[model samples]
Target chain A: MSIGSTIICLLGALFMTSSAFGQAMDAPTDLAGTGYFRDQDTLPGSFRFYQQLPGGESGFWGMGPSRPNLRRSSFKIDAHDDVVYYSPEVRCQKCHEPQTKDLHYLRMGITCVQCHRGQPVAGVYQYYSPLNPIRRHAYVCAKCHEGATPSFASYMVHEPNPIASEAQGRFPLLYYAVWFMLILAGGVFVIFLPYTVFWWIRDLVAKLTRRPSHGS
Target chain B: MAVDRTRLKRFPPVQRLWHLGLLVVFMILSVTGIAWMYFETPWGRGLAEQFGGFTGTLEIHRIAGLVMLAGFVLHLLYMLFKIDWKRFSQSLMGPDSLVFQWIDIKGFFAHLGWVFGLRKYPHFDRWSWWEKFDYWAVWWGLIIVGVTGLMLYNPVLTSDFMPGWLLNVALWVHRIEAVLAMGHIFTIHFTVEHWRPSAFPYNASMFDGSVDLEEARHEHPAWVERLEREGRLEGTLVPPPPVPLRILYFVFGYAIILLGLFLLVFAIANAALLTLF
Candidate 1:
């Protein structure tokens, strides 16, 4: 209500907007499937790699395996489970062109289920390959949960080193930004509204009554 | 000093509605808000469980917070339109009210002495330093609480820039701040308005939008003096009948404090019983 209060409110609003924008622009690098090793020197040794070919699943490739780009080896799937054997082999071509595929997965890394058809189910191991112990194993918790097909945590080349294929979930910041703006705006109003209303009525009455004022 | 009855205008309908709405919602919100922060604490857990658990309490807290936030925005816009910049600056940017001044600082110490009759009672104005402190503290608290609250609202979005630890820190700060704020509001703010000897009952100016002349002079002499100087101090008008509205305020305020305390006690008792059983 008061000019000072209004200005403060505006400033708060601006701060919130800027904070939100800053957070949105600065995205976190997802680190799923990169084989997070405790030691930086052991990063290469910690990772195993694989890619599905036309007919069968590939063996676990070492850290510097032929396909250095494919960071994850989802080969642990047991042959007995029909769901595990029947998963589709997704390639870059399905979501984006070949050109963007490298950029999307490698340059701008993404999470496991981003391209995968099924939601990840917890506590069910479908694929296992000892060639690259960590990367070759696949667990689909969704197999037991609702609406789950065979699922695997995919690996991205550009993902941060030493990643947990399982620990992929992240907290959301933009939602906070939006909410922060609204709350800040609200706070500003709460701070000023009372005095403004009281003053307005008081001033209006003073003028209407032709009250002689103390010149001070 | 006397209340310039002629000068005191009736609060607008919108203002009244806003105050009433915020009062009701804030009270509910505060309860649920505290319950949220303490959901893990023994008392908080009990409150949450009584209300049907954390999920249910969280839902109500969010809904109430949103409503309060809406009220907050409307009040801001109203003030933006209501007050002139130059005049408003007197209250906002001018020197701190007397209660915040060096003299009042001295008064605080002296009043402590005066409690033993060594000095006179401190002369106060429309607002005291403690009141001002509370006002500003509430705003700051709201900002911290609101921001942290949002950050925690959606972990997926917040984890973009802020680390899990930082969110954890925010959570810690928000929770601690809520408890501290609850204590301060309950004891300090409530006591100032309702626990003093002369004004022991309460002050209902926040609700009815008016304070009687005697109260005006005793509580806000400077304002009374200003109205007198301006010749708008109701020099010729007969004063209105005394309304013991402060009594209502005292009853309501005391009731809330008692209820909150009782809730706290009951929670502790239940927790003890469960532990024993």
Candidate 2:
């Protein structure tokens, strides 16, 4: 072959090799077919830069790279435990349709992420569970109900279901009782605190002057 | 040394100590309890922080409540054992007792008349009608507040016997009773016993357990006359309180009174602001 033709052929072969490698990198993984699972990768942009890692597992394959199967490796089940794991693909309405009838937020079409902290997108959701030791329900409730008064917060959160129902049914009773006591106490204070202070000052002045004090 | 015939015994040493202890404990309970109730308010928040935060405030409140309960129980036991039961019972039913009697109704009207200038100061015995009211009201308050306080202090244990709603009820009752007791003590009781023109600044009889004989005669002539008839006037005479004791009384008495007055104003102002806004 002529040297110029040989150089052109070599350049073409190099281009083909590089292009083939690029195609391999760009191709999507057949994650389910490979018996591997991406724990929380269902949400778009949720695992953005780390999508290739797939559930944070590490391995190399000739075709491309093997993604992780979190279910098989990282996930463990104990017979003694009672934890239930709901799939991200399952909508809350699917199971909670009965309970959501009276829930205020659910009726308003506000999803779990509104009050809960975490990512929820592209048919997937991830949040701190109540079972988690670090995150408590009160902290989550406070995220949205920060402006609520202490009494209201206690009534809503701490009171048992029956007590809360009764309290709601007789809301006016609690309201009036609190106000009545406050007003009664305030009235007594207003009537007597200033009256006593005034008399005390007057008596002090009378003693200093050695004068006969009124009502003495 | 000649006995200071001008002074007469009022409260004895033990009674004086009990009163002083009660005053201190009651003040502590009020401060800690109010701070807990209004924990979100600026003053309340500041107080909680000063005491090492919300849990610390709660612990202090519970401890103060327990102390108050102990004091009350001890006082009751002391009265039961130390007092002559027959005399005490007779006194409770008699004209000299601090219990509410038919005469108190007459005395209350008489006092109202005196206030309106329709009569002179009605003759008062050892215990006036208002004084009787104060004593009985305290007893009633102790029972209600004490029981509710115990229930609240042990909600988990109490929940087994009582419905959960009862805890809520107990909370309201405890808070309301506290307010009532505080209001009565800081206002009517303080005014009648310490802030009155005759006892202005304070009634040091609670500290030194003695009163000026002339003032005692003026305030409780019926008791003085009875004592004189029984020839016990001389027996009740005591030396005038020494200067140092008087100074100490003035300092502690005024401090407590002034602190109570400040709290009263703060509470009322906070309540008004809360109600209006």
Judging by lDDT against the true structure, name the best candidate. Answer: 2
Q: Interface RMSD values for the candidates, listed in order?
A: 18.0, 16.1
lDDT values for all models: 0.47, 0.61
lDDT (tens digit, per residue) of candidate 2 on A21-47: 887333335421121124332322333
TM-scores for chain A over all candidates: 0.24, 0.25
Top DockQ model: 2
Off by over 4 Å in 1: A1-216, B1-19, B34-46, B86-118, B235-254, B264-277
What are the TM-scores, per candidate, against the unseen true structure? 0.50, 0.62
| List of clashing residue pairs for candidate 2 | none
The candidate scoring highest on TM-score is 2
Give the per-residue lDDT of model 1 (tens digit) for B227-270: 66879666533433255754665577568767766645554454
lDDT of 2 by residue, B1-277 (tens): 6645688898888989988998998888887777666564677667678778777878988998899899899988986786567677774576555668777898778766655446555677787787776677778778878998998886545544543335555676678889889878877787878866667667888899998987877667777888899898989988888899999999998888887887777777677433111
The interface root mean square deviation of candidate 2 comes to 16.1
RMSD of 2: 20.1
Q: Residue B197 in candidate 2 has what lDDT?
A: 69
Report the poorest 10 consecutive residues by lDDT, candidate 2 chain A.
Answer: A71-80
